[model samples]
Every structure is written in C-alpha cells, then in structure tokens.
Target: MIKQPSIVIIDYGVGNTQSVANAIKFLGYKNVKISCDFNDIENADALILPGVGAFEEAIQNIKKRNLVEILNYQVLDLKKPILGICVGMQLLATYSEENGKHEGLNWIKGEVKKLNLSREFSVPHVGWNDVIIKSKDPLFTKNTDLSNFYFDHSFYFDCYDEQNVIAYCDYDIKVTAAVQKGNIFGVQFHPEKSHNNGLKMFRDFINSIS
Candidate 1:
C-alpha cells in the first residue's frame, strides 16, 4: 500500500468532503480517500484540506485529532503538495480573527482577517466569482483568462510571501484566491463547486504528484 498513490482528504469534519471527493473522481482519480487517521497521511501521495465554519472550531478539531504537527511536518518537511480550500485555506496561516485570536497551521506566514468591504458587497462573499491567475504554477497550467469559479468565505489570509499567490479575486480589495508555496497549495474558493474550471484545477493538483 505504501507503493500505491492515493489522494487523502484530511477528514476534520469541517468542510464538504463528499463534493471534493466527487470532484476528484470527476477528474478521473480513482484512489481518493477521506481519512482522519494519521497513517493515512503517511500512505498518501497528496492531501486536500477542505473546510467550512468557524476558525476556532476547526482548529480545535485538528488539535483534538492530533493532526496539527503531522500536517506541518508533511508539507514543510516532506515537500508534499497539500491543497486547502475555503476555511481550509485560512488554516494554513499563523492566525485568524474569525471569532477571537486563534492559532493555525502556520505553514504559510499570514493572518486571516474578516472582510471589510464597502456596504455594497455582502459579508460572506458568496456565489460565482473569477479566479484571476497571477503566477505560473503546474496546478494552474490550464489557462490564465481570469477564469470564473465559486467562492464563499468571510475571512481570508494576508500571505507573507506574495510570490506564492497564484490567483486573486475582488471582494473589496484583491484577496488571495489561491496560494502555492513550494509543495503547499491553498484556495479560498470551493473548487468542487466551480464546475469545469474547478475540475481542471483539481486534476492538475492530482497530476502534480504524479
């Protein structure tokens, strides 16, 4: 089993796992598994962290599962491509201001702050939006036409390494829609909900390890 390549979706019970799994399957990936088991991390070739809800709750779940250290070690030391979606993306940073002050994975240098746009924009920033590809990365080899994708989040990260940002979207100012630093990747949008473009992105991510 160690020799087999599997895409493990870290099951912290925060995000839309079924949708993400379906997306991976739509991309022609057959070995996708959702697991909270620590051994699953070692056995898999790639990881996807899909999240939703409050930052504090999610952090507590990760900590309770004793997965914080493993996730950091895997992405930072193992040099594996770990993709985080939505609130999952926010968790890759050092801190978040969703409720009170909360610590995160700290794999990327940044803080998650609430959206402070004009009154015209909604608070959550839901629905379809464009993902403006900003940098060159294998995960985004599809194209760079400012592709439209689904986005639903109230908080976002202020990345320390701007170069790692592969895409951006408008909410009030330009918020990072996607990030890729070495092997760690993250997205603020729900790729599983973005239709064809999202499928392509997921496929590219799976192919990154292959």
Candidate 2:
C-alpha cells in the first residue's frame, strides 16, 4: 500500500483535537498522532496546531508542557510545515490582545485584536462567511471561492506583512482569515468543522507534506 502522510495533531489540552485528527484521517493521512510530547511532534512530517479558547491560557498551556522550544526547533529550525487553526492561528503571532496583552509564539509577524466592526455584523462572526482569496499558494489556492469555509471567532490576526495574507473575510471590516509565511500557515477559520470544503483543505495540507 502507498504510505500515507504523517501529521501530528498537537494536543495542547485545548481546541478540537480529535476532530482535527479525524479530518486528516478522513483525507487518507492515517499516520496521525495527537500528542504533546516533543519527540512525537518533532518526528512528524507536518504539524497541526488546533486550538480554541483564550489566547493567554493557550500559550500558558503550551509553555507548561515545555513545547515551545521543540515546536520552534521543529518548525523554525527544521523547517517543518505547521498549520494553526483559530486561536491556534492567533498564537502564531507576536502578541494577542484577547483578554489582555499576551505574548504569542512569534512564528509570524502579526498581532491579534478583537473584531472591531460596525453593527452590521455580530462580534463572533459566526457561521459561514466568504473567504476573500488574496494570494495564490499551494495551501490556499487562488481559484478558491469566497464562501468556502466556516468561522467562529471574535479576535483575528493583524499581519504586519500584507504579502503573507493568503485570504480574508469581511464583517464590516477586512478580517485576516488565513496567513502563509514560508513553512508556517494559519487559518482563522475551523477547517475541521467545515464539511467537504474543510476536508479538501485537509487533503491539500497533508498532501503538501512531501
């Protein structure tokens, strides 16, 4: 049998862990491991940081598990591809002003801020919103339709380098929906819960590992 891609679904004690793993599995990436162990993550072909909840707490948990250095080593030093989803994506930036100012992984040049929008759209920006594709990349294609995925967040990434922004969504304002900087990637939307469209994204990410 052809060997499937190996993806490590990082278990930082937050977010939709199993579902993300399940989604990858559904995409034929059977060699999926959900773990906080440095060795497991370090050895994986690609990493998936699936996170939900507050920014500070998530960073605290990642630090508590001693995953910071290993993650940096693997993703930065080793140049392994990593995908951060939702709050996980926010954590990839330098800082986030969710509850208060909190330090992020600094993997990408960006900051997280609450959705500053007019009364036309709600706070969370819940449900399905169109993804305005900004760039053509292997991870997020250029031909992708705007209304392709699901979103559930109040805060979003404000990138310093506009060139890194792969796509975005509008909710009275242009919100950062996805970011791609070299080997690092982040999605403000939840692909795991986005049905078939999400599955296709999963396939793209996993297939790009080799």
How many backbone clashes can be found in candidate 2? 1
TM-score of every prediction relative to native: 0.95, 0.96
Model 1 accuracy (lDDT, Cα):
0.86
- In terms of lDDT, model 2 sits at 0.87
Question: lDDT at 124 for candidate 2?
Answer: 81
Clashing pairs in 2: 131-146
Model 2 stretches astray by more than 4 angstroms: none
Q: List the pairs of residues colliding in candidate 1.
A: none
Q: Report RMSD (Å) for each prediction in the order shown.
A: 2.1, 1.3
What lDDT does each candidate get? 0.86, 0.87
Give model 1 RMSD, 1 decimal: 2.1
